[model samples]
Target: MILSTLDLNPVIDLTDEQFYQLCQANPEVKFERNANGTLVIMSPTGGETGNRNFEIGADFAIWNRQTQLGICFDSSTGFRLPNGAQRSPDIAWIKQSRWQALTPAQRERFPPIAPDFVLELLSPSDTLPASQTKMQEYINNGVQLGWLIERKTRTVQIYRPGKPVETLNNPSQLSGEAILPGFTLDMSLVW
Candidate 1:
């Protein structure tokens, strides 16, 4: 079930540390924090969505291992964006140099940097508008590349800084473009 902004107001606001502790305390629940300090507690995805997420993450993992281009993360990795939002994309990658710049403590907690690349796979419960807004947020927070994939519509929205959002309908695959260099996501399994 989707929790609207109105439903979140009554909940006690939490400091970043408190939110991190809460997440650690309840490892099974997925949580996100908005720029305005709204806490979002999300339910786990269904089996199909879970499987698709796994496949997508696996592809990134494999690519990272081969090229050693950067660090790759699954959905569970929380990132503290520059805009003060704590978000965890379905799949994310950070440049090695950028990741190395973080102190060990910062790396241990919610990382205080936006990923170089991010992918969000839309599940049945996810609202399209919300997801699009999130993609825009990533761009605003210094993410170089972002993909919002909608399985139901078989469409992908590509986000790049200073460029208009590009939409691809039923694409066979998606290129990482200059950001990832040679990494391509095969959509055959994704769709």
Candidate 2:
């Protein structure tokens, strides 16, 4: 929903003023601001596709048990853009400690920063280059790693800090690596 004022194309250009105008137009959107002045926006991404939900659910059921960090979410989670804007990732996770630091009042709504790890499952509506830019936005904002899962190809792009992105097609195990040490993501179950 943070893309409301901007284009979701490869350029990834949007203004905060336009974003607020869109928000004023759409009451369905919900916004949250963190202590650091970061903002998160959550909006219904349109009607859900039942099958994708099943895939995401299955992935979470297995992945959450291995890590102390929060599991995963297809529900909108905000990420601070390089330009101080925010974008809603398809799936996001925060380090348990970072989240624990929040006050109960702050936890009532979504937190206003990027998750430590993020997964953007590419829907038919998303553009690849724009999605890549979205992943970069999280990285710039301190996200340790990101996954750009392409549903059509059944592949994923693994983004790690200070390294080139890794493209995996039909990966067997989605390891947490150092960022999520000992945490294993068995994306094998996703359809």
Question: Largest TM-score belongs to which candidate?
Answer: 1
Tens-digit lDDT track for model 2 on 18-136? 54555567667655332233444444444443366556656665667665457465544444444465555666767677777877755544455567777777666556886787778
TM-score of each: 0.94, 0.68
Q: In model 2, what is the error at residue 121, expressed in angstroms?
A: 0.5
In candidate 1, position 58 carries an lDDT of 88
Model 2: CA > 4 A from native? 1-50, 65-67, 79-83
TM-score: model 2 vs. ground truth: 0.68
- The best candidate by lDDT is 1
Task: Give the range of the ten consecutive residues with the poorest summed lDDT in model 2.
Answer: 1-10
The sequence of per-residue lDDT tens digits that candidate 1 reaches over residues 1-191 is: 24544235467767789889989998987888889888777767888889999998888888889989899988899999998999999989999999999999999999999999999998888999999999999999999999999999999999999999999999999999988988999998788
Shift of residue 148 alpha carbon in model 1, Å: 0.4
lDDT of each: 0.90, 0.63
Lowest summed lDDT across 10 adjacent residues in model 1 is found at 1-10
